[model samples]
Target: MATAYRQTHDHPKEYFVETDTDTEDSDFDDFVCSDSGKSLDATIFADLEQLFQSQGSEKNDQPGKLLCEVQTEENIAEIFAEIRKEYKPTEAEWRVSNIDERKDHEAASLLDDAFESVSSEVEKSGSIEGCSSCAESVNVLDVSQFKKGQHISMPGKFGTIYQHHAIVCDVKSTSGTKAELELIHFENKDKSIRIRKGIKTYDLKNKQIYLKHYKKQRYDCQLIVSRAETILEDFKMSKFKKYNFLLLNCEHFATWCVNGEEECFQVQGALQMMVDTLTSALGIGSRVVKVVQQLVIMSTDEIAKTISSAIVPEIVLGATAGVYLLYCLAKTAYLKMAYKKNNLCLTCLKITLKEMWLGFLVFSSTSVVQLLIYTFAVPAIGSGVGIPLVVLSVLLSVALKMSVNTFLRVLRNPFGKEKTKLSRPSQLSIADIVAFSYYRLEHVAIVTDILDVNERAQTARVRCIHYGLPKLLAKRQIVEEEFEMNLVNSSWHKFDVDDTTSYACEKRLSRARERVGEKRWSKTNRSDNFCHWAVVPIARWDNYAFEEVNDKEKKNKSVEPFFNKYPGYIAEELRLGDVVDYKETGVLVRKQSKVDQGKNVVEIDLIITSFWKGERKTYTIDLKRDDIHVMYYKPALCISMQDRVERALYWEGRRNRLLWTTNGFIESCILKEEYLDN
Candidate 1:
């Protein structure tokens, strides 16, 4: 047991590791987004980088490729537009897939003729239209360029191979007008997430920096700074979390602060671009490469199969695994080609199935190797004793696992027709797994936030384990999804997941929110339906970590703040009539956030009619949240209002001025467009 202790933990420095050899791209000059308030989506840059890399075959020509070779940003935009035009489901596709109102999931497919046409044209182009010469004077990014709470990326650890991120927090002291600045960042060495001083600040200032800004704001700057401060406080209180490269690294910290989502892309661009370069250089698969198998897995699989066959030729275990894997690979490829249209749910299922099959293949062969090596060679227990002991132990382990699973099933679900009674929820815990059913399947997700503490207000935020298979895969597929709780209904049956990581709930929730927003907004044009829901992702998480926070603590630091409802202009652009949707089809939720004193107090009232499987219910669903950061994107024009009230109270007997009741019977006053304009 001691010898088998493989310290699988990543070296903290691996977070900064990059390719050894420098490419022309090693000097990929960082560009500052003019919009400082815009949400910095690193993934978009990755895609853009991919487009540029596609142009150049050699590494020498790949650096600054997009800016020089691809010509203007217009070419990149044109390509993206082509992708959208070709991929977004048509009316016939959407309706044929589900008239019951399932979210439109785009089918992943082979390079369509539209994409092929666009790619061919791009490759054939002989000109660089808006290409700037290499001798052009570049804008030098310095300390003075960054605004308060602005996200800044420093090029290092190999030029643009990866970037170190930080938030330009504030001035350390007044010191007249020329004050020293403080940057909040995650330091792997100190194992602290906080504001750095003199030497650390000096080191940061010396690095080549660039601003990550977008034209439209994803979140308020004040909100961004406040979350950064909160995370810092948690560190001070002895909740020490080490720097995990794959998990909570520096890139993850800075992005989470700027926007309420935790994403480094798990990426910044250069690292992924390097891998893509290798694939291209090696002449790996082509357009069809984007099919079922992961490229990395596919590249080395034949080698892995060869090794397995050589290792255990007589047992035939390796041969069995190889054949099964080939079958799964073939099946997935066939499914990908077969379901390239209306039945997108089946498409998602195919991907899920591929993962399962691949996992089984790996697990079966690995288990055989591990069992034999550990028993015979390791610890050197005699073959006579080890073989019988290992076999009996395996049988017992299998039986025990089966028994425990059956026991948990009994506790969660009684032996009767499906219905669960309220036993006072044991305790409110963060990142608890929420379990429910998706038709016949048992679906699960990590509970990211506790919406309403009240028993009757049974709604919670969840980050699913790909539980949203039936729904179209959005950027954030079914992540941070809020649904009504009723253990009986087919549309709703849910409870805490049995295995809740006592820690790491904050990371899960943040990632889910970010991904969900990413997926939904990936399209160039956000539709009217996007505005219908107001359930905002709150920035609050368990600090005491659900350890019975008292009433006094609850008041100052609200576990969940009920709605601070007031009738006023929600946004200047949104008219009163437009928000008060009468149809049970969906209910608009709203949120108000402000920093009172130093604490973030968010008021959220989500009377969202949870989009069910066309299930009609008498009661509309309700959910609540705290310290909300998500703000609705103000629409350019207000949606037209129709007086849908079955019965309306005429305001002074004028049809232009009247009152109506929505799905929740919430009375709202509406006036004509003429009056509204005035």
Candidate 2:
């Protein structure tokens, strides 16, 4: 059974891979399955523990350090430090372990089903009996001892793999004998954090719990609790959907609350263990010889198919790892150069490690999907687990990758962090830069032009050099009331420049508008016009014009896109007046027919403008090498055209940054300083 997804349906592969997401949707739907309710077999870890003990005995190894009982503060700290190191299998043993941890986890649902089937049969025979409850264990955790704003963590059932973390948000009736304690943590079903009172609402039967402690307080627990509370308050108003089991789960919530950063070392270690095992199993390293020999024996078509699919999780993992390596190295090198450091400072190491782990967290999401697909004995078609797992992976990976640029600004701390004081005038004038903080970074924008919509109301034509998907620059019209009052919820700063220069910039912007507006969509009916922004279209064949050629033949002849990095973006397909994503973007020609020119010859003879990248340059452009594409449809939003959007997309996911120009960074940004060396 095949399911067709709309091309615009949310999917992450569209960013890096060229294949139509619609086609991949069914494949993804078939390949990976996720069941949040499914539990890992406790015996898996029990087996690991048993294996470790047996191996220790076989090696005649001396007894290792046991976990020190947490009687004092030092003992608790020692337990955390030691447990992380103890019973840890070497990479070699882990890879060769009979358990095949990756396979087990990737097909956790299938394995759980199998375990259930066996258990059911055994129960029917009455040979195995079980009874369990934590009611008697109520005295174990002293509610009064655990204070508000303290961390509580629970280990996976067998006490080795995953950990769920939460913070004590409240203590009701502290003087009462049975003091009611409230904890906050992300709940998967709701996709938001919820506060629940004590063990009555939380299951604590089959796991060991830990209370985070330090000899010296390492964090402002009160502030941490405050952040978590704020999140809960905000979430009550909206379902944030920021909770994914693998990436932004409870652990990430807890950590972010405490440290102002999302992190999960347990997830990190587990993924590494899985990757190491899979890499060995896939014959990525030592088994390359075997793979090569197998490939050599295959027919040419088969080999071509295997290489082109790029579906092998291990291979994709390697490629992604390479990309992340360059990403991190470039970041570290640039920061070093910025600080002019010949020696590594503590900050350098800290930033590098931060980037490394976060980048890997996203990278790990990609591999998890691939491995999940590979796990279910992916028939030339259907495979493990199901839609839920792949969807979770897609959401996690895309969310994290999107966060990279946003996070860099926050982590770097110097790029656009301006200390110079600037005030927002009571009334915003043209060419003023407006700054606002959203999510993470400080976003800046220049008011291009102000338009008088009617006698009583006016709108500001605001534009920002946004580093968004498909395009870096974005513009829209906002009512002056909102722009001035509370839309941005931040103040605007006037640009300090000669009135003539500011006036010239204002004209250039008007000229830009006039250039594009001449071809802009006109409302069929005479009604109030609405803000125009890009809307990625669905039903490509219906809206886009393409030569009627065999897709297979076209695939071979296809060249790199000039406007957007999205695949198969042919120049022949673009209609006139369409917004184009380009290096200097964009002055789209207004016409009804397609052009005779190919995308490759795209020569820039003379473009006299002061835009970021297209600064009055006369150069020939080869679209094949550089990225350019007719961005998503941007029919001017009007009373009539608005109907098309509403009729087509029930809800466009989002029509969606921070920086100031005075920080000396904009110059470096425009120069492409990092690319200059290359």
TM-scores for all candidates: the values are: 0.22, 0.24
179 in model 1: Cα distance from truth in Å? 8.5
What would the per-residue lDDT of candidate 1 be over residues 237-305, giving only the tens digit for each residue?
322245666666666776666543345653533443443343222221211121112222234777646
Best by TM-score: 2
Residues 13-71 of candidate 2: C-alpha lDDT, one tens digit per residue: 21222222334212221222122233333333344444446676654221122111111
**How many pairs collide in each candidate, listed in order?**
6, 14
lDDT of 1: 0.35
lDDT of 2: 0.38
Provide the RMSD of all predictions against the true structure, rounded to 1 decimal: 29.8, 30.3
Q: Which stretches of candidate 1 lie over 4 Å from their true place?
A: 1-143, 157-160, 172-179, 189-206, 236-240, 266-271, 274-678
